[model samples]
Target: MSTEKEENQVKSKKRVSDHGEVFTNKREVNAMLDLVKQETERVDSRFLEPACGTGNFLVEILERKLIVVEARYKKSQLEYERNAITAISSIYGVDILEDNVIACRDRLLGIFTKYYINHYKKGFNEQFLKSTQFILSKNIIWGDALTMKTIYGMPITFSEWSAVNGSMLKRRDFQLDKLLENLEFDNSEINLFSDNKEPVFIPQPVAEFPLTHFLKIGEYE
Candidate 1:
């Protein structure tokens, strides 16, 4: 019988043949991640892995971000926790396989909780844990990237989460297709790489919410 670790891995040959799923090994994952080392360390830098198989890239990225968070905000536990949650929110992942999506979410949450336990040893904040889990549910989604629709056949929409003015959280939703289209460079040569060129794609918000705290998102209906 395959060990649980082997079962959860994204590298099974049969899975590859069936789903085109081949996860990056640690060495390659580190090498590629090092290329964007700076961004990986920045707590608020948004990263999306359209094919985030069991979260190989997102896990590494979160580890790096948490290291930076520890160095900067360890003295203040609240600040560190908030920034850590922001780091989790900034990562987005999508995988067509429902199993992969579930595994990825659990893996990332485990990583965050492990870090939290090590730093804040005395108390268990159930609310904070729930809030983080909620963020992960929004950030890591199950969907087909090519079709740009969720497993349930709805348009894939991502909620952009931000902590504004300290402790007040804000969320704005945007359709995946529009977000991708807006990111593409314009065909017009007039403003190619112009320093003063206008922004290519400004993602118009589909829905906006102002929450007193991250945990309140679950209650917002």
Candidate 2:
């Protein structure tokens, strides 16, 4: 029943040849994400797309999570904003192309803004938008996933945003390479085990910031 143009899948033949950047169509993206429907609906569940070209997958995931956020928290603007922040904060992406990264961030922001406006209209909080933008800038990376490094050859770092004491958010940064290394080792035969005999891989944070109010998180950066 959907009527999206096939031409939208690829920006150009050169991009396909140069970067192999054919985007996943909406129908296929939905089909694939339906495989993990529950996670897509969970606001705080984290997702990372290594080659998220304009965020076909991430945008769908955000929309699904925001629907849930609205259904559960729409009555309270504060609660809606907090859960909305959590939803956007948990979605991450990486693209080698700078343009793709910028577009992906904007698309996700637009979705969040649209939903917020639909619910709050004139009461929309500017600080919430700023905080969401800050989170997107940190969450979506302009980096090579294979190399686990940014365009400038620096290690790709991601921030873990956790809501604390209701309105406060705690941020911790972890390097992509280190996280993947531990994840791989954790799944190997010689897996690391916690005291309770459960497999665990606790990655050390590169940096941690003081707890800041969710709406004021951008100011802390």
Candidate 3:
């Protein structure tokens, strides 16, 4: 097959559906997104574009949020700018394709760096990239958006979320707050990282073949 076809296939593989071609049409999408933006309060809101193909949705969301924040908080440009950057941190996304994922991630971060560096004196954390990978990984993830599963290539169920996230609920010795104190989870202590609340990844089984359907369960009684 031709390079054009191959590229399209690779890109499409990451798309949410076969109709992804029409989804990239900016004029059409921006119109709908604009209508949606009208109903929501832009202040401190969080949104997730689970399948972030090329980040068109994210860009529009950011643009609309900036306008809203700037108009509402005219005097505190710093507040507006911070609100904008913080709003970006609120947006989360995932895409299966590496190229699309990285591209979307860079575009979002570029908007942030430009605004923070230009408008504020107390700019971004200098080691923002190195220190808080969430700045990179949190906003835009690289995985199947539908599954919300671990990198283990399996679909995460409510049970898994309960087990993983609930691990925190098990501890009572530290005042229900110290779990995040960096004393650590997953056999590692918080002292190693200096903070307990930060997230840690758990290891899981590898996939010999892509497991598309998730682990199904019956209704909870």
TM-scores across all candidates?
0.86, 0.88, 0.53
Question: lDDT tens digits, residues 4-105, model 1?
Answer: 888757357678888888878989999999997888888988888999989999999999999999999988888987898888988999999989899999
Go through the candidates in order and give each one's C-alpha lDDT. 0.82, 0.87, 0.48
lDDT of 2 by residue, 14-67 (tens): 688888888889999999999999888988888889999899999999999999
TM-score of 2: 0.88
Of candidate 3, the 10-residue stretch with the lowest lDDT total is 167-176
The candidate scoring highest on lDDT is: 2
Off by over 4 Å in 2: 1-11, 182-198
* Candidate 3 TM-score, C-alpha based: 0.53
Instruction: Estimate the Cα RMSD of every predicted model relative to the unseen true structure.
Output: 4.8, 5.6, 14.7
* Candidate that beats the other on lDDT, 1 or 3, i.e. the better one: 1
Stretches of candidate 3 above 4 Å error?
1-22, 39-41, 73-78, 121-133, 154-221
Q: Put the candidates in lDDT order, highest first.
A: 2, 1, 3
Residue 59 in candidate 3 has what lDDT?
70
Instruction: For residue 119, give model 2's deviation from the true position in Å.
Output: 0.7
* lDDT of residue 37 for candidate 3: 62
What residue runs in model 1 are displaced by over 4 Å at the alpha carbon? 1-11, 182-198
Between which residue pairs do clashes occur in model 3? Answer: 180-196, 180-197, 181-196, 182-190, 182-195, 182-196, 183-189, 183-190, 184-190
Ranking by TM-score: 2, 1, 3
